[model samples]
Target: MSTFIDIHALQTLPPSNINRDDTGAPKTATFGGVPRQRVSSQAWKSSIRQDFSESLDSSQLGLRTKRVAEKVVKQIEQLSEGYDKEKALSEVAAAFKTVGISLAEPKKKKNEEEDSTLESGYLLLLSNQQINRLAQAIVEANGEKLKKADVAKILDTQHSADIALFGRMLADAPDFNVDASCQVAHALGVHESEPEFDYYTAVDDVVKEAEESGAGMIGTVEMMSSTLYRYANINLNGLVKNLDDSEAAVAVAVQFIKSFITAMPTGKQNSFANRTLPEAVVVSLRDDRPVSYVNAFETPVKESAEHGRRYEAAKALAAEAQELSETYGMEPVKSYVLAVGDLKTALEGLGEETNLKVLLESLSTDLSKVLAN
Candidate 1:
């Protein structure tokens, strides 16, 4: 039997530039003939990966960087004491070359910072355990010749949860690519919204009024306020396969569910301080394919006389999800809902009502049962 988890959330935010476009305005997309605030899938995935560090062990996380040689050199220096910097660099370069990465020097940046380290010219997404294993292998080789097989064996992404969930693609080596198990959609506002500009000037405190008649600096920032609908689905079977069927897979799933609830993107956060929590969350465990209820807001939810925007959005989401499940004949194995304020009653009839802690506990139990079978 196949099992999948689908999550739908409603989060309200005040005016903020949490995510921006190239034009320095809040990101947006047109849906149902109206412009809606958007936060890209890449942005939220990055936030989720960062949150994993706080919730899971370091061994389960991955590192993404173009400075593979530098990262491996540090490991070599730590593992093999007294190894000269030049020797370490040479050994790591040789190891990487064996894995199909070219050692050609890259173009200098505009600022041209003095960087002596060699790079692969592309992002190398590797796991912490894979890096440590490579370091151990390099140390054991004792400056002798290394083989391609040695690099391949150590570079295998065995215990990396981020790699398993978000996936990685090594351009130089097609064999190293991993298919992502968890799929996340871009978060979009439930209603049409417009970006507004804040224009202001700053005066230097040290500059005297007599010396400086004009302001020291002036700028405009674009921001928006809206209630967002965020959705994500996890393929439990694929997650199990990615982790090599380890028992710890259940814990990984649980940690991710928790992070999805707590993590928020930090774009101009210090300037805007748009910190907020999800007002509602509805999850479903189904043997059928994952379903997203975003289409419910295609017409754009509106604030009515009796209910506010968020409350109306929750009602629309609950109603749509129920209709879709019934229409598509999706017989969910289990379902749960956690909502606040008016959402508590709005989505109550959709599933078993519970809080975050209770929901997480119940989901963990479900994952364990799947592994046992």
Candidate 2:
């Protein structure tokens, strides 16, 4: 298997807030002495993770939440006889103690209804299988009686595809932290871009024309339009090791690649229904270290000059990859390009041309063969 699987794509989004900052404007970053539209790595990765449910089975996924104690209690209540919520909470707390996690009382919120739900002090990254096994152990141990060895065995065998790819950091239990095998760069526009505001108002029909001439509500939202440059890298060895199954790891890699290439972040979708497919994608399988070609847009491609922003973005990316190989004497073992319309450039020369379905099949087969060797 190649040591790394790198994905680079170009997609154009119309005026929309696919990702927003604290002030509710579309995210922005300064590059080449100008502000450009930005979609954060967290936002894009979250979108990709959500898309996994559509393509992969529940068994291949992981759950991230602070209410782990509540989830575990539910499992325990189902499996163990004569265990109520209060008792289950105690049992799960004992299990957390084994793993060095504190089961704190659920923090009360002003707007939240009162309940007996409990949570871990921090978010727990856990797989379904791990949760079931831990619950079963608690039941077998008869609540608050699990031995250290039981906890050790449960934690050692915890395997999660999301946790493996995205990683988890435990501030209290650093030993349990998993290093992320997948790295995603923030998606940025291929051209210099700025935000524009959309002033809007809503009218109330209930009010009489004479009684209320003004609108019920008024607001302005910040948005932008541009072709984005997105990139990500996956470490095959690290993923397989984290998942503890080579075949499953390959399947996840394929699913993730397909999803990441196609998924759209759903921020302000109702207001701006701006979903779009990538204009072009370039996948590189390499044995050497990973490289990000985002710098290809440092000078920013211009729409008026390049005809369309996506076409020019594709051209710039292809040129950058070609130049990198020549300068560093590092050519990828294999490369694939998926493009739309007449936007094809020299990228076709650097790699084979394939559609998404064929690309997924070919990538899975190649990665599996490498794993076998």
Summarize candidate 2's per-residue lDDT along 1-373 as a digit string, tens digits.
Answer: 3489999998999889989988998999998888999999999888898998677777677788988877888888788666878877887787778768777778787998888867777788887777888888878876448886777677656577788899988777677788888999999888888999999999877765557788888989999998889999999999998888998899888888988988889999998899889888889888998989988999989765536777777888988998999999988988989988867763569688999999999999999988898
| lDDT against the true structure, each candidate | 0.86, 0.85
Top candidate (lDDT): 1
Worst 10 residues of 2 by lDDT: 303-312
Query: Where does candidate 2 stray beyond 4 Å?
Result: 110-114, 207-213, 304-306
Which residue pairs come into collision in candidate 1? Answer: none
Q: What is the lDDT of residue 63 in candidate 1?
A: 89
lDDT tens digits, residue span 277-340, model 1: 9999988898889999999999999999999999999999988988987888876788898888
RMSD in angstroms between candidate 1 and the native structure over all alpha carbons: 1.9
